[model samples]
Target chain A: MVNANITNKMRNLRDAYSSALIELGSKNEDVVVLDADLSLSTKTKRFGTVFPDRFFDMGIAEANMMGVAAGLAACGKIVFASTFAVFATGRSYDAIRQSIAYPELNVKIVATHAGISVGGDGASHQMLEDIALMRALPNMTVIAPADATEMEDVVPAIAEHSGPCYVRIGRADAPIIFETHGEFKIGRGLVLRDGSDVAIIATGTMTAEALKAYDLLKKEGIEACIVHMPTIKPIDKKLARKVAGKTGRIITCEEHTIIGGLGDAVSMAIAEKPVPMRRIGVNDVFGESGEARQLMEKYGLTAENMAKVAKEMIKKY
Target chain B: MHDKALIKDLKRKALEIRKWVIESVYRAGSGHPGGSLSIADVMACLYFHEMRHNPKDPKWPDRDRLVLSKGHAAPALYAALALAGYFPVEELKNLRKIGHFLQGHPCMKKVPGVDMSTGSLGHGLSVAVGMALAGKLDGKDYRVFVILGDGEVQEGQIWEAANSASHYKLDNIIAILDRNGLQIDGPTEEIMHVEPIAWRWQAFGWDVIEIDGHDIEEILDTFHEIKMNEKPTIIIANTIKGKGVSFMEGTLSFHGKPPSEEQYKKAMSELEQEERELNG
Candidate 1:
């Protein structure tokens, strides 16, 4: 179980991605970079600086960028398109569906600034429903890496994946959970902690919150397991069934709407194999303009809120 | 390459293709025969003479990419695919039937020659643009070709794609507007005015040209010109709906209607005589 009181957690988001992209670009000539005029924002400018020929500045055309990625994939090129989650998912849903997902093109739609944690930008820029939109499409593998370390693994893991994939990353600096490089496979869940009293299933930025909750529960002498489901679309049914069957009590957390996201993905996976589950998310409400940390705290996306839900689920079960 | 000989050969192929369109539509009890017949000559010129492709290897990486933006006109494309040896010519009868690859719209998974599955109008151009951009990125010399119905250009996405294509200076991409001047609703002008079509594409920074859609030699020559041009090209091929059939020509009623039995006989006779003259 995680310890909430643990301090001095190392945080690195932007630079970690910049290094990963630079490394990937150096090794694979087939790996091309596409930016929607947001090279600096998504930290892909590092790749742009290194490989100018392989990097394309599409000038804010996300739809065309997606189409171009699909085309490149058809011609045996691995394309990584980068932009804010809002524009990548909202502005180019049709292009992703018809061109990328329909043919199952090997295109990685890497969306940064995902969820309400993309604060100060307000509801317009912060995307909470991208997972739902992407999950609805067939052959679209959706993954929201836990932090910088996970993203380092995810970038290469998805590049080798042969079909359409969406990698959602947070804009804010976050904790490094994995001590060393771990095996981060596609369509598989990572078990952070093991227990039988309750199961805390979370994804993306919320994985840290669930881990924090685990420590809080242990203080109360209640044992809880934490499962970080990075790949939301594939849902990691193996782990979902295993954890749910073992604990029989579940609490889902995410920095997104409860309507359709990590919560919805987990619930759908265990719908038939039912459990006493509670979801902690935006609850179908729009986010407000504030600091990223303030928004996370306001929407119950913190350690205390997640712990409260976990405790409640334990009582219910 | 004379106009007379080119028209004679194009007319024969167009009529034969029209006959197949009617027969396939009649068998399926559904198809867009008017647009298919209208675009038959254009399709023939592209497949038989214009495009650099190999029938045996549909996945030839360096082959030119052809996207049917006016995807509803699949009967014409299907006929072209069949004639190009993608499948048996007899398989035309299986169009739109259950468990048949020859559906009302082209599906890449179902058929060998289809580049991309397209039924939703105005989406194919974006795919074609992607292919063109990819060719540039990969340093491949293969060109990208797309055919759009006049009615399909009305979609906002088409304009979006066009602007992007020109912005990228996709000289390898060439679009042919099937100016059959008719859609399922009726005359394109009557339903939605898309006049000054060439000007619109030209304004978007493409190299635009206008030509008779039924002219095979002109179609072939225009494609060559586009290949040599420095910008993306659009050839507005002016054509009549239901081009080869006498009663059906320039009529909207046959846009989706298959010819009746008696009408089919007349169409077959006209095509046979044209074939005889071409051979002679």
Candidate 2:
């Protein structure tokens, strides 16, 4: 029932991020890390331990930290600046847009604790609009990796790529769907399962839920196609067109707010070839203090909700 | 301080930059002339006299970087970049045109020799600190120079940057405050009161250097005497708003407004008169 015991097998994505950072540090001599006082939570302090001098804790100054990241990148250093998603995107979006994105500097904004998955700290600490805010910028590449294995590939891919990119990472212990690693490329979506009835496109931790929902839809005499889109900007439009041609009906799933995010991007991509589509995400509302799993259930972010929504999309179409 | 010939040459260059600021803003019909004219000498000193930058190799690694935090003063930077052969001086005429590289603010992607794109206030210093920090980490000898506005320092991020510069002991950075004493709304003191300015910087763990920003010799000497105390230094360059123009000086109207046709003629004549005096 929706992978209830998957939590026992799941590993923290932050741990994978830490290991990838260490590997990136060894490969690129100019790789540097900067954090705004949440190094422990974001887990960038692991990089600090290995490369003590290269890691800078900017002391709870997210805006200044972003500016400093831009400057360092201007000086020919590949900079990865990390903080909570709320502070990284919401508190310092202007700095990110002007200093980092405007110049198209080589700064990777890898923010953890995104979405309502940031439990107990409540709505004040969670971020639900980062993907929307970052994707709106002209030169920003937005990515939300699904799990620890996906983060391992994405961390190096963004670092080796020379441009501004915003990466959304999660805080909760979610299930690991992919046992085998796939080649990570920007703007390419992987079709994990093939079906003719409907398509369920998802990103971030929601991809796992989409997988669970796909199985449920299959058992209930409905065939579903699951597409995992990691990169939001430079979205896989060709894939959307191909999927729309295949299934003819679609349901988009994301942990972000429905407005101006993956849903809008998908809609814009398939505008030339219209198809019946339903966006599944947090409606216009804020989150509250609760357990991460409970919040996911309360926000209608479970496999049961997605399966119900998938059935509705099929019937409506 | 004794190099009169060099000072005269710099004064002449500063006068030329002032003329460019007036002409470009007047041509654009909508640009900041007050702050642009206020820090012309400092821009002149940096681009022509002090900075070890290569105009041909705009991305030279060892080049000393300058971040104009008071980015409304973009005309001064554009003029200096043009005068230094980074681009043709004729491009200066198209200050904010549709297809020109020179935008409303400094855009590093479009404009060469602009180290970082900056328009919003209080962000440049943090970038400068990062440049300095990267230099220190890499053992590079290049320095970072940032010019901030007296009014712009009221942004909270300025102090956050200040805390970082001091926390990391970024010695190869110098922050210059173009203290023109006036802002768009009113005098900075009457508006927000950034008084005891030198003391405030000192409290932030900076070695403060107060100077008459217009005097070329004083500016040159202050740069020469930046002691190596392993701390970031702030040079308060006391300047007059719209320095070279007679009618626009100390006038709040010229902060963001261009001179009108009649006012432009009068300002050009005033600048020409100053240029004649400098040549003598």
Candidate 3:
């Protein structure tokens, strides 16, 4: 069911987010978009163009932008606020927690430039712990779509789901994995490939890497089952347990830090019937100035690293 | 000039709101009374006279909205909400209690008529700006009233919101700054000097109005004055901290500390005497 030439077509996920937001604005007059001086980067400017009256540019204030989004949501507007993931999550965390999440407002915080893949900007630009910060808040639905196609579905899905949601996307173009018409739900996981030897659960851009790792492991006669988990807050617990029970060995991959991210979430989800698992992500350290691919390789967020980790886990336990 | 009869009625309502503020905080055993009492007159005027709202239909889409940015004054807001029939007056007694709708801060989800949930300072104005911007987008005439504490303006987000409100030309937002001149630790001037607040608002492109916060007539007149402004307006309502209660007035102790048994009796009797004087 996976695409054969996934890496041939690379598209920035923010493009899909922007187009989907435009579509959402056309369908619902109450849909409003706001950006805090990153409209060009986050791609919320497309929605602003289509629905000029419904769009708000909140200058450079991310905290006030979150509060304004909450206020608009309070007045029955399906609000989508965008900025870089670091500012959207860390800078305005209290505003999101107090105004949006606490009231359970229908505000979708769609942030771009997540993970260490925001290269050349160094650690300040790269957001490594947005998932941890967002998922910890109650009533916040956290999602990180794997590729552009999934992001297209994610935008409208979060718009229809009436509550506070945080959707993180990347700055760089990623491998095109899912079809354009693929379905997306807030808390469901998709099984991209079926195997019995080991289960590799991945999210965001790392899911594409996991697909490549599947072929890498296949060359070594190791059959791998790949799961694409977009939603991290109300995580796919049933899938986590089922894959853990079926495969006996599991590998979790993400572009975020190993701490309090997909790795921790999967660990807690499969803890009832625990198995030997390995987490493939950035170790607890800050990223440096380099190309995105080099940073991913340096941080060990690669298909080769995931395949190696799976092999190590299989041998050790 | 305002109608004497109407002014008297609003004064009575303000006194009633003050009584409820004292009773609710005294019942809860822990709540902010100083700021709550400071804004009683304005809250009474807004909920009863100035705003267009239906207590029965709290979710009425076209109704005016109010965000109590200085949300520690929940007792005051809860009192005004109850008196205006958003909920039963008896519910004010359950403020800050376990499993009660009247939370420690104003929560829009738990309580009806709470337009926005706010406990953290500096959040209310931005939310109100959003609401006002929505009103403009929908071409609705519904106004958003936000009550802010003078101390809360120290938050950077407040300035951000101020910039957005005027930048968008959100004429539908009317912010009432509860200039009680005091904060938790000490006076606002000594703590963080929010003086020359009128000039600050004017510089932010808001049509600034100075009025007596505790005076119902002046509060009504200020609301009327801003009814036709082409820009966002801020009413700098100069007020004594802990107004109406003689011993508590102008003191910083009763800001979050609930009245003792003796203090509670004195406060209630003082409000009762004021009510009697107003009737005469």
Candidate 4:
């Protein structure tokens, strides 16, 4: 029993991103967009059409694009650099680290096609380690929205933020988790369901999976709460601690490397105030080319896998 | 901004920057003084004479920006910044101290006036190109200057940035090479030759100029010529490594070695006389 009364016409994360761009482009004249040959992919073609002068096609040069974004920020322009997560994080990590993070400039690095869901493009195009790279930087605010609806709010919030920020989104159409009208804030966790048996901490496409697991566990007479954590850097310590207090067992899930990512972040946050936890992510291995759905299932990143992990953890609880 | 007065003032500052390079490194007991002293004159002309910027508002939209691509020569840039009213000149003595804004290499967060933090070599020019391209897109008439060492150009990334600057037609970006001919190792020509340099830049679609990097008059005139030209400029400023210091000038051993207390005194006396003549 899911709530059938709630509208299914809610926007996906990509739609939210385009809608926010149109809104922000209208409000702020200083807001500029740069694409690493992927405006159509990231859905920033709307901004390109509306503000033609402000949009730049850097073209397969992610490092130069990042450096340009930093320069624009330094020169009093609000810059949103859009590209695939692979190039935005992997190809230009050093540039972002030195130019943007080291200087603490206000550049929004908006990355689409994140996680293993990027799929058949294969492991080369897939960016499974972006979260870890961006979060490790000193002045970067790392974000991976749970759904398209949440992406709409996160984009503008990152624009208002006066430091380096990285926002990751997926390419494939997933369930619209948010109602599209709920209030959103960066650096704050959004609690989707309330329970006490076990806690599932999730981000990006996996948030929807976590919700599915919550429903399955409830039917099986297990109470598991779901927390969609979008902003990974300034993590929601209050929400994390509160959930850990109510339910002593926790499971962290993401579509990233097991090391230096959401799992590591949550584990360290709880270590300060001890808690028992298990991590759900790529098991410290590289991804290969495959269907996004198949890859997610193969890597044990599905609702079934989450439910299984929760059941195993409940015995400990 | 008369050429005569500009040259007179910039020459005075250049002498003092060279002196500070020797003195600060001597105080630290170890630091790169040769390259720092080598580029003092070029840095002086760029800051006090060539580059258009406001010390009051460093981020002024129309203000010209400069990036020290060869960050090891930060002593010279830091000295020039102090004289340009970025911060108190007294902060120069606090170099490398923990919690001090001034680090061995320029850190943009820690320092007030550093445009980009450029410790790792072969990185700053791409950033400068980006700034210049931003200016073009914004319709702002700001020029960007980046200074590279003779040896630093040996990096493959430098060529990548150069290719990119030309490909994008980033004419607003001017790259000045301090052809001091010496790097941390012996002469750059001996270690790795980067000569036929002007042809290389010209091939890359730049308006190239060669000047005696030490001659204040030539340096000032070349910059003026560059501002009028629509193409990007590269001034290959030929300079002596440990310029103005008697025993250290043009020598490879002094590239990173600081002088002893006695040598520091000798270098100071020589620079003091040069400063007087420059001011007069």
lDDT per residue for candidate 2 within B1-280, as digits (tens), equals: 5477888888888888888998888898899999999999999888888889999999999999999998999999999999999999888899988888899899998999998889999899999988999899889888899999999989999999998999999989999999999988899989998989999888988889999999888898899888767899999999999998989888898999999999999988998988887686
Interface RMSD of 2: 0.6
> Candidate 3 chain B: minimum summed lDDT over ten consecutive residues — where?
B221-230
Candidate 1: deviation at residue A250, Å?
1.0
Residue B193's lDDT within candidate 3 is: 90
What are the TM values for chain B, all candidates? 0.94, 0.98, 0.98, 0.95
DockQ of candidate 2? 0.89
Residue lDDT tens for model 1, A91-114: 999888878888788899998888
Residue B253's lDDT in candidate 1: 89
Q: Name the runs in model 1 displaced over 4 angstroms.
A: A1-14, B2-10, B256-280
Please report, as a residue range, the 10-residue window in candidate 2 chain B with the lowest summed lDDT.
Answer: B1-10
- Between prediction 2 and prediction 3, which has the larger lDDT? 3
Q: Name the docking class for model 1.
A: medium
- Sort order, lDDT high to low: 3, 2, 4, 1
Model 4 chain B lowest lDDT segment of ten: B223-232
Ranking by DockQ: 3, 2, 4, 1
lDDT of 1 by residue, B1-280 (tens): 4467665766666666777887788778887888888889888887877789999999999999888888888998988888889899899999998987787888776888988777778787777877887788778898888999999998777887788888888999888899988888877899999988888898998999899988777877777666545688888999998877788889888887877778778877776776777778
